[model samples]
Target: MKKLSSLGLLFLLILFLSGVSQIAFAAENPQYGGTLHLSNDADWDTLDPAYASGFDAGEMAVKFYDGLVRFDFSSNKIVADLAESWEVKNNNQNFIFHLRKGVKFHNGVEFTAQDVKYTFERLYDPEVASPGTWVYPMIKGTAAKLAGESAELAGVKVIDDYTIEFDLSEPFGLFLTHLTLPYGLIVNQSAVEKYGADFSQHPVGTGPFKFVEWEHDNKLVMKANQDYWAGRPYVDQVIYRVIPQPLTDIAEFEANNLDRTVVPEEERERWLNDPEWSDYITTIADLSTYYLALNSDFEPLDNPQVREAINYAIDSKTITDSLFPYYVAANDAIPEGMPGGSDLPIKADPEKAKQLLTEAGYPDGFELDIWVSDSSTSVRVGGVLQALLGRVGIQVNLIKNDWSVFYNTVKNGNAPAYYLSWWADYADPYNFLNALYTTDRIPFNNQEINSLLKEMTITTDTDQRIRLSQQIIKLADQVGDPYIYLYHTSTSYVKHPWVKGDLYHQMYTADKLLTWWIDQDLKAESTN
Candidate 1:
């Protein structure tokens, strides 16, 4: 044989790895039957779709509920779920959905257009006070209903048993994408009536899996729905073990007691380098951003120079490098990989930050209290900020609280400064810009940016929408320095070799759990 050149050797290595990956993937032939053991640091707050907010609850919602449309991970597009097809007319203000035939809820209730109407009406109901109500402002008469002026939303209409229509007050381009979120998950009307306020405990929906049990801080169990329209789930059951500590979860995963769990930051590199464990790790850049939110209404933070100085004091890259190996430093409020996102020229400049503080009448710096959750990541980030801001002569006091208490304090605007992360509810720039900046939760505001955001929602032209989004981001970066952009997160999870399916989703983390299965032979070998 002729001597192979260096390039030929590299090509051969690539070919070998590619073939190995394919063989490894194909080895587990989509078998059915087995319980998937998973873990979460926090327990779910609620399983009711109307009130599901956190990642834990959202994960459960994905298995126990079905929305009109769902995001297709393969195509990265909005595809049909319960609603098989849809049509838009009247300049995007009107929408008609043709429901999938013979779909049944977990309780065997036939899914229909009436269920769709009921779900939205409940969302818009003032008494319900669902957090999901934010998603329905575009629908006609929703504002009036929310304000107690009307009892019904004039937009949702049951055209027939298998069809429904929506009339928006104006054109909203993200309407379809919004329907893919938990808020749009349809519920059986009878179940809601039967369960009432306790529906969160006894949730019923049309999905691949049905709720089996939830033992508060222990575990949540779900079983496959044999009558599911999509098809019966591959896994027979899913048990989410509530392990509060990441280290504990990792320990369980290593012991084979847990099928999958998040790999702790301390062990990430070691696991990646170990050939025995490398193939089990899966990492994906999450569509999310973390930031230090300054209550712009507060004294020092109200000053533009002070806000800018705070942004300049902390080095986001250094923080990410030390504390979060999987995260990328974010300079712009909008995360990277999204359209219209651009990085700001913000970096650590302690001297400039001090000068800006002096200019804002705080020559000796000022004392600021930062409220953060008790999560490992939050505590580390808070400690880093405390140290960095101290270098600029700012005295920082970190107040740590449980997740629920911390979230309530920040959401109520009681915290002068807080650390939080916003994950995209839908894959749209508007969700990031409008939800974080324009909302009353944060004190940032600019009439031009707000107007542009509103116009962007109505604008159908892609180029015009992109331009408007870019303008909004630029204006927010210049004026509304309410948040110090930190970093975008990359999430990693370790799965046993027997676990098989699409496990990563940019938006919905656990949505693909229904499709995952365990190889009987591989699992048996691991146990032996």
Candidate 2:
């Protein structure tokens, strides 16, 4: 009887070991199904890629749409998306793209070269009024299209059902980078015509996720596309909840209600010290620049001395210290680590600021209206600026508006002075210089700077392009002083350990939602 009992015990032990092995294997391998809960501080302005001007809209746009090419996170180089391959011809003035076969839009319509032609023509349509039109003006015949003289983009041609071509008016060295912008994303012509003006609400595209629903200020949900040209997303669904308050999002993350969230400035240290949470935290020095934009067309700001005084009044070092570890004080228009970025002689000198203000005919400091988004962080920064500018005799009247209103106001160059940040659309320094200092966006212009910018666009040599970028920055600083350079921002987020395959990219305009998945068993074990 004792021998029999020993044999039975051995059999039970073997079964136990087998169960343990199965569980271990499941934990290590990629799982196929789960949900990822994410948060956005505000509702996206629009899902229409053509008019998606803000970060919120961009976050959602890339998931539902795709462009001809996109930035590969691993290489930080342009890679094909819808297009299988492309060729630069005619001295870089003419280009051709070979589209992937059998790709279908969300509505089940097969994609073709015609769709590509329609997308670009719609973008150049005056009725669209896309802010991104500037990115493609180098295309031949855009002038006639913009003026309503032509309904078609004369430069864009459909070579066949599987191929398309673009003829540029000039050789734009950064043209591929231009195609990587969200605005360059392709759309189905039938979908746009069906939805008409309400297309923003009903977006259709050939991407990894399909739009399920958007509950206004509450949450936006997307489901994986089973027919995605690339394999379907690991997560079954992606939920982006609009939690405007940072603290609230953090609380949700801690309570296991969220998969990941941005760690608030006040909570960063605490999260880093926690044994369990610290492992989940990821940080990246973002390719973004935060600054105070003084409208050069507006009142005293039109005076360079006044702009210089405003720059001198703000103690950037102090501000950088207050947000220590999250931001680095910006010394030039370009973000640190980017090519051509350098620290100029600019620094905070209260005395110098006072002298400049006096020289600009505002000895006692004058009242100025500064516009900012209603986000808590923006408001806090605005208050800090108001205090600093007050020290140099500028009374700042803080005007806070929701992101949509604030984005439009500043984008239209209506705000006298505004606290804003420019996130990198592409890694090139010209992206920053051309977008911020050009007369098209900001009210400041110097013929020398403008000429250098135009030259930088076509300069193919990396070194020569960098040299031109630096020259433009120096000239803009000495002459235009269009913006008060503040600091470059960082991205920090604490994610649950079970949330896997996420990356904190330097240019994280779009999160790689398709690659991410949740380990349900591990999450349950950890939460419990």
Candidate 3:
């Protein structure tokens, strides 16, 4: 009896281990290699990670690029990609990264610590005009170089072929986290040399996937990097079909020509109601804020009180209903669940907002042009913002244009006071308020806000510093420099019934694809 009981326990242990092993996809197994088709409503603006600015471009690059550090969206934690392991100096002024051994770029060039050092230095080089330059200011002379005012960035040093040490001039607890920024993604030096201005058009990286080809608006393809340090991807290829219009995306998915497409917001439920399609639909709360950016240097927006008043002018509840129904939640400038000061509060007060505008000398309100992209949803967002301001007596002359022109105008910081857009980068409150508002940081910044942000950078204790950070967050709520606190996005990616497993939409879906697979019955339909 004792022998029989011991044998039973052993068998149960083996069963448990087998289940765990299958879940992690450990040990040897046949690779389920195949191609996947994904479509998005917007086309990628550029493929260069260093210069990729919007979600439209950045998400497309994630299929083929790997950053030194990347965020695990499901866990909201930084995990290694290019670097194997790392440690932060006690003063928060240094981080040493140990690169994985025997890894090579898609172009077959050996990667070294020098590549890491050069990447940051090049980004800080004003001639490159890399938008990621804002992240290197803690490297002492980085700011000057980024502005074309100086020559060298003083922080990066290669200790050896496999190791690199980064010395920050100031401490930032979120520094490692910021390393997950799109601008910090790894690129092939060989490809850049070979492709030149065409590098973006034909890129290469050390990610789990390798770029195959991009046929413009038709399709973009990538194949599995079997030698990937993270292990082989389940699907061998990811083919992105560029479907610019939301309606077109819907029609293609329904017609079965496309395997998957970004589900049109209005048709999510329609798919959900269809049993054949409902099982294929998946939702990931877009940890993104789609809102308007006020050009602080513009006429009416130059007044801080007027900005504060505009914050109270919008009725967000109405916009969320009209635009996305109950699919969104009210959002402050900063995304939810991020570390923040205890003092911050979300705002809404039409009466007080109008009074503040009157005090700012716009008693009869002001006439202004609000700019938006040509996308249908973008137009809807702009129109609602126009109506919200109208309620507060500000007559908004809505100006619509293509996304490329809209982004360029806003980035120049010479926008006509109102421009609508969103941030999908960075997962902290500082990103929304401090990074965007402060001077010497980003495209739209103010010197006064910049002064306060410098202080937040120096405070090391997590809690104490969060207090200083909170002050700015509260200020954002009060003034609404670039936002009136609209709703955060909740979107669905509805696919065909055969589509079983897929990545979620935390804006970093590509990183979590190992867990996804096509249904057994539908596997035959997937094209390689």
Cα RMSD (angstroms) for every candidate in the order listed: 5.9, 11.1, 8.5
Residue-wise C-alpha lDDT for candidate 2, range 1-528, written one tens digit per residue: 011123223333433454564455457787878888999999887999899877678768889998899877443568888999999987678889999999999999999999999988988898888887877998988888888999999899999999999999988888888887778889999999999998999889998999999999999999999999988988999988999888998989889899988988787778878898878786555678888999877889888888888889988777777655557777777765567765476568999999998988899989999999998789988988999999988999999999999989888878999998877878888888877876454667678888998888776788898788778777777874878888876656899889876655555444547767788899889988
In order of appearance, the predictions have TM-scores of: 0.89, 0.85, 0.80
Q: Which ten residues in a row have the lowest lDDT in candidate 3?
A: 1-10
List where candidate 1 sits over 4 angstroms from the true fold: 1-28, 147-151, 358-364, 373-376, 399-409, 460-466, 509-512
Task: Give the deviation of candidate 2 from the true structure as CA RMSD.
Answer: 11.1
* lDDT ranking, best first: 2, 1, 3
- Model 1 agreement with the true structure over 191-290: per-residue lDDT tens digits: 9999988999998998888888999999998899988888898889988889998888888888999998787767878877889988887766567889
Give the per-residue lDDT of model 3 (tens digit) for 398-432: 88888888777766665665445355566555665
Show the colliding residue pairs in model 2: 365-393
Off by over 4 Å in 2: 1-28, 127-131, 295-306, 323-325, 352-379, 386-417, 440-443
Candidate lDDT scores, in order, read 0.81, 0.82, 0.67
Could you tell which candidate, 2 or 3, scores higher by TM-score?
2
